[model samples]
Target: MKKLPLIMMGLLIFSLVPYVESASVGKASIDQVMLSLGESVTFGDYKIQFADIDQAWTQALIKVYAKDGSLVTSKVLPTGYSLSVPDNDNPLFYVRLAWILRSNQKILISLESELELVEGDVQINKNDAYNLPYKFNDVVIPAIKVKVTNTYENKANVRIVLPYETITATIFEGDHYAVPYKLTSDFQYFPYLYLYLKNATTSYAVFDVYLPKYPTTVFQLGEGGAGGTTPSAPGAEPTELVYNDIMYEGENLIIDINGTEYALGLNTVGYYSSFTLFDKDNNPLKSFEVKKGTGYELSEAPLVVELINYESEYKRAYLRVYAPRGTEVAPIVRDPKIEVSVSTSSTELLLNDELLVFINVENSGRGRADNVNVVASIPTGFELGSEIGTWSLDTLNPFTEMPVLVYLLKPTQVGKYELGPVVVKYYDERGIEREVDSGNPLSITVYAIPKLSVTGEAFNGTWGTYVHTQEKT
Candidate 1:
């Protein structure tokens, strides 16, 4: 497992995201909300609606339309995500309940309307003392309560930004609006929540903060100056722990070896985690917990550990794992080694000449890649059609390569041109995704075809004589 610098890893992850496509219709939508899809509903200042969403996946491309029949925005909305139109006084929109599908790539629409924003009636008690920014005890899994200035309109645009994600929704005003969030144990970062009141282009950002979860002390051991469970802050937030890395159960994970030190710890608030260990060289190894027959481990060295639940059923158990003497633990993500090369049919061409571009994708890694796509960038001013778009391969096995005719175009003007720097995106067996850019763009020169009729004098050097031809036309 080659190590990547922290900054490089972040940028690599960011670069893998592709441009969103237009959302097609879906079958299943989120229920629980009472509204039909495509039904034009009016609210504050504008009318909004959407086509019935009949699909369900992790991500959905939704195109929103305002009352003017103009596109509001084509947004990639995820499950549990709501986007508030900022700075607009009119808040006519509603997103029906959607059923999420695998890969989180698609969604099932519930109602029949074009995707619209939600609007409805909500009543709040006047006696309640509203807080400016509500504070949550634990962001990882805590209930959130939102308090907004009382508005005559029942539904208002709400925009929220979590540490890892952002969402916009039409808040159905009520006595009080409260939502609960369950943070995944996937990525590590601090929690920061931002909410906004979106009305047209003017948005009033909400204020919110997270207070770390305090541990519930079960008992104490090693009295006096000896040893015992770490001191507990019953009322204060717990400091970030060193052994906070969590691996879920039934995951085929890759473990990267960090510096020379590795340690694992379990908390009272915990889930089951068991895994096998293995090294980068495919070496097998085991952790001490597995030797005692209390946990799960699939292999050695760079082990595959399955984290299930607590050690016992008491709702409280503690365990710690320390990596073998010389290695630290890191997450297993898809690391694809893909190379892209491109070539054009000809280095030179005449105006209006048809040209073809070829792209080659080489997989020099161990993982099996799927959904390999290639897209070419044709130089500006070239005549291109939809056919000069994306090409794909169902799969590219490890140590193999694939080639595609990514683009075909005809030059309409005479000049130098470039075509290439094809972009490649693919997913490995474990759902590790990767993307790559091809080498420099391919270049071609185009010369305008000479269109002329000539009648001139002809000369023969071999004969040492010059002869002029009149009436050569």
Candidate 2:
């Protein structure tokens, strides 16, 4: 038989359902309860004490009563009382032993003196028979103590409050009426701890410890470095790093990765350090190793970079560099010197032809300069005169002067003419070329060429006796 097509084969598949039922369910489990009653406790004395009547015979005699002024035992009249028959049988106690007792059950112990009758005789006297109900005084208990367990040394005033019936719980700290407890028991004997006394008859109670008022610390973070972290030396010495007897002043700890210190009273888990180191001086210091166990011995002040003095002028005009006062690093002489030149000549000569005019050119200040040149402007109808000696431009240090020489050239024009807009351009120590030109055009007054002629003279000429006049126009 020919094979069916793939699509046809898939369409022809047949399946049977399995006879089965799948089952699944989610489950959960509870962990042990770990309730910490914080760190404070308050308990009052004369708090209601419990007696297991069913468990212990001759238990602390207890009297039970109802709140509605019903008839209950007036006082916890203890067993072993004498009967009417002198030394007869022992007084029978309706209560049994091993019975769990409760405080709020309106129970009063029989041993208390408040239950005593005023009349000693069996006959009721007029004054003692109709007497009012008895009143009982309250009990007072001592404060509880709590000691915290931690790895570091720390001093703290722990607080705790006690619970009471007539009054709400109260707060207490070190020397502040705090209560104490032992971890060995769950306080079954005394369910409530007294916190404070509201009045003569009421008391406040609690079971937790408090640490509300603790010291606060402030610090900066990161790479630019931080404030100082020098710790004061151990013991009783004063240091810039450590401040004692100051409120909230902790040892300025410089902690590296995983560094540790033992605190005074409490144990503290170490926090990972932020890489910021404190800069003792505002100045930058060279790289050095900072050991973890050993505290850094920082300079009390910041590093300083100063400019001593500048010496070179030409190769460089401004001379200023920085150097650390007492460190190995040298100071930098950024852009120090400035070069300048002034030309005291005009571009156009305003003088008569061949007139000689004296001009002065100078560098004027302290700066290196070179490539000096000078030229004189000649007006129309002027001619070149003798050349002056060449100006020497060997070198011009700071505050030095250089001169150039140029003889006058005749002016060709009668109007204003420029002698020299003397252009002085030179390279600074940085090898950067700079130029400066200075000149106001010079004005010249040219007079017309003078004419010399003979006016008259008696002369013997070929034309005899006539005044000899040779007039050539």
Question: Candidate 1 — what's its lDDT?
Answer: 0.40
Which regions of candidate 1 are displaced past 4 Å? 1-334, 385-390, 393-395, 428-433, 457-473
Clash statistics: count for each candidate? 83, 87
lDDT of 2 by residue, 329-433 (tens): 212112213232323234334444356655455554334555444444444566676656443343344445443354656656465444445555555445455
Model 2 ranges off by over 4 Å: 1-353, 364-366, 372-381, 391-394, 411-416, 452-473
Q: What is the lDDT, from 0 to 100, of the residue 236 in candidate 2?
A: 18
Worst 10-residue lDDT window, candidate 2: 211-220
User: What lDDT does the true structure give each of the candidates?
Assistant: 0.40, 0.26
lDDT of 1 by residue, 178-229 (tens): 2223222311212222222232112222222222221111112212321112
Q: Candidate 1, TM-score vs. the true structure? A: 0.29
